[model samples]
Target: MQIIIINGPNLNLLGKREPEVYGHQTFEDYFEQLKTTCSDVELHYFQSNHEGALIDKLHEVGFSYDGIVVNLAGYTHTSVALADAIAAIPAPVVEVHISNIHAREAFRHHTYTGAKCKGIISGLGLKGYEFAVKYLQEL
Candidate 1:
């Protein structure tokens, strides 16, 4: 199956940004682990600090992908456009979060994308991506 993993905003700073919350692993390390776990699946990964770039890629590969796993970073609590793009896609989206938004700040509790996603995985750090991939494989 073809699975697309998309990350947004400050996720590029995974290892250095906030080690306590996001973990010590870099995004590259996380990607390698995902690749190892889902070796049989065709995984395509993309990350961007720009919201429009992520949205554009989502639209570009939406039809071709079997499933989408997104860690939308700060965009989860904001960005209706991102949510709209996910909703427009034919593939099932699983929203992943490194930290538990509900326990962090009141503003972080709301997710514009979660409502449209097939399911959500939060507060699990980088392992959430693997869980999402496994879930997609089961589906």
Candidate 2:
């Protein structure tokens, strides 16, 4: 199986940004863990603060990849175009949120992209990425 994890916006600051809410581990470190544990699958990752770049990536892998795990971060609540990109894609997407959106601000509680995903994994930290891949593998 093959899977790609897509992240958006300030995610590049994972380890430094909000250590309390997002944990001290950088996503790069967590990604290495994912690659180590999920060696059986061909896994890839892409992150961009730019919305257009993220959309382009979705389009690039939308048809060819087995599955996609996405954490649109702030874009999850906004970006109708991003949601549309997911909806338009053939690949199954599992939306992930390191911090539980429901437990946070009211604005974070809803996701336009989540509505288009096959399922959603929230509040599980980086473990959610693994779970999303596992779910996609089952499908």
Strongest candidate by lDDT: 2
Residue clash pairs of candidate 2:
none
**CA lDDT scores, all candidates in order:** 0.91, 0.95
Question: Which digits, one per residue and each the tens of the lDDT, describe model 2 over residues 1-139?
Answer: 8899999999999999989999999999999998988888999999999999999999999999999999999999999999999999999999999988999999999899999999999999888999998899889
Q: What's the distance in Å from true for residue 54, model 2? A: 0.6
Instruction: Tell me each candidate's TM-score.
Output: 0.97, 0.98
Sliding window of 10 residues with minimal summed lDDT for model 1: 28-37
Using alpha carbons, what is the TM-score of model 1? 0.97
How high is the lDDT of residue 69 in model 2? 97
Error in Å for residue 7 of model 2: 0.4
Note the residue pairs that clash in candidate 1: none
Error of 1 at 33 (Å): 1.7
